[model samples]
Target: MDRSRVTVVIVVLAAALALPFYAGPFWMGLATQIIIFGLLALSVDLLLGHTGLFSLCHASFFAVAAYTTAILQVRYGTPTVFAAPAGVLAGTLLALVFGIAVRTRGVYFILITIALGFIVWGVAYRWSSFTGGDNGVTNVPFPSIGPLAVTSHLQYYYLVLAIVMLCALGYRMLVSSPFGLGLRGIKASESRMRSLGYRTALHLYVAFVLSGALASLAGVLYVYYNRFVNPVTGSFQISVEVALMAIVGGSGTIIGPFIGSGVLLGLRNWVSSFFELHAAVMGVVFIATVLWAPDGLVGLARRLRKRRTGIRKDPA
Candidate 1:
């Protein structure tokens, strides 16, 4: 990374580390949410930005994982260690089945994902006995091990921060790895990649599964934080919103999704306080981002810097 970016990262980290001391409980909760959904948006970008596949059903995996953890803990009295992994497993298993959609592309792929997402939402909304219908599974306790445990939201905030930081680092390494380069190659030209003997289908399928796993992990974090799982958590709207988050944040970059998440969530919280049409406000923001910042906020920043540099070099 460049010096400017490194400086910006250091400043951001310092601010995050100091947030608990200055911000209230509500702000802490919101920050946690931004981190969680940022992970979800990042997962979507694994396919959208890297391999040029747009998936609209990531919320299915998120919901499945959340519901699995909730049900196991609430009904069966399972411990956090077992329930969390089970949730991840359940969602990953679903992803393995849904990976079949990787066979399709373009509009067909989008439609298939939409249908798949709706199926999960339908099951969650209608299957009252198993899923608790709209109410979902509730009373999920904060995650704890044999000795380590979270007693408050502030403590959880630090835990979430640590985990998200770790994920961001790992994700950086993944994107810099050879497999990540292969995904980019496929994105540039699948035919050319295939000509070079790359099994494009298998590559995309594996990415899809890995992306789903990441979404599942986000869901586990969310369920523990929110202490509930609802059909809305798995709804089509959520999938759309997270996709928009990735696009608005600069999908290919590690920090972009989190920045987008913070912007969108913070805007919603502030706007919804007085505006009844907050959803419309969000739509307008998306339209503006698409029109003026096609590559998203990070790209916009780079463009402005380049323009300034060009101006400085010219005779004036």
Candidate 2:
């Protein structure tokens, strides 16, 4: 990373660590939600930003993992150790099956994913016997392992921060690795990548599964934090919203998704207080982003910085 970027990261981390000291419980909780959903947006970007696939079914994997963890923990009294991994496993396996959508491209791929996402949502909504239907599973306990139990929201916030930091670091390494390069190449031109003897479809499939696994992890974090899982958790709107977060924050960069999440979620929280049309506000924000900031907030910042530098160096 550049020196400026490193400095920004450090400042951001320091602020996050100090948030509890100045922010109230509501703000702290909102921060925690932003991080969790940011993880989800990051997962979506693995396909949308890097692999050039627009998937709408990621909520299936996320919801499935959440339900699995919730079911195991609440109904069967499973420990966090077993339940958490099982949740990830279930969601990943679903991703493996849904990865078949990679066979199609463009709008077809989007349509297929939408169909798959609806299937999961339908099951979650109608299958009241197993899934608790629209009510979803509730009374989920905080994650605990042996004696290291998360007892409060503050503790959970710190725990989430620690895990997200590790995830961001690992994600950076993954994107810089050779496989990451291959995905980017595939995104630029799949035909050219194939001409170069790359198994593009298999690569995309793997990316899809990996993305789903990340989304599943986010879901696990969410269920523990929210202490409930509802049908809305697996809804199509979530998939759409997270995708917007990726685009609005800067799709390809690691930090963009989180920034987008903060903007969207924070805006919603603040706007909904007095306005009943908060969703419309989000739509307007998205339209503004598309029309004026196609490359997103991060890109906009870079452009402004370059312009400032240019003015400083201008001979005229």
lDDT of 1 by residue, 1-316 (tens): 9999999899989999999999999999999999999999999999998998999999999999999999998999999989999999999999999999999998999999999999999999999999999899999999998799898999988888898889888888888898899999999999999999999999999999999999999999999999999999999989988998888888788888888898899999999999999999998987898788878888888889999999999998
lDDT of 2: 0.94
What are the Cα lDDT values of the candidates?
A: 0.93, 0.94
**TM-score of every candidate relative to the true structure:** 0.98, 0.98
After superposing candidate 1 on the true structure, give the runs of residues whose Cα lies further than 4 Å from its correct spot.
none
Question: How much is 100 displaced in model 1, in angstroms?
Answer: 0.9
Worst 10 residues of 2 by lDDT: 167-176
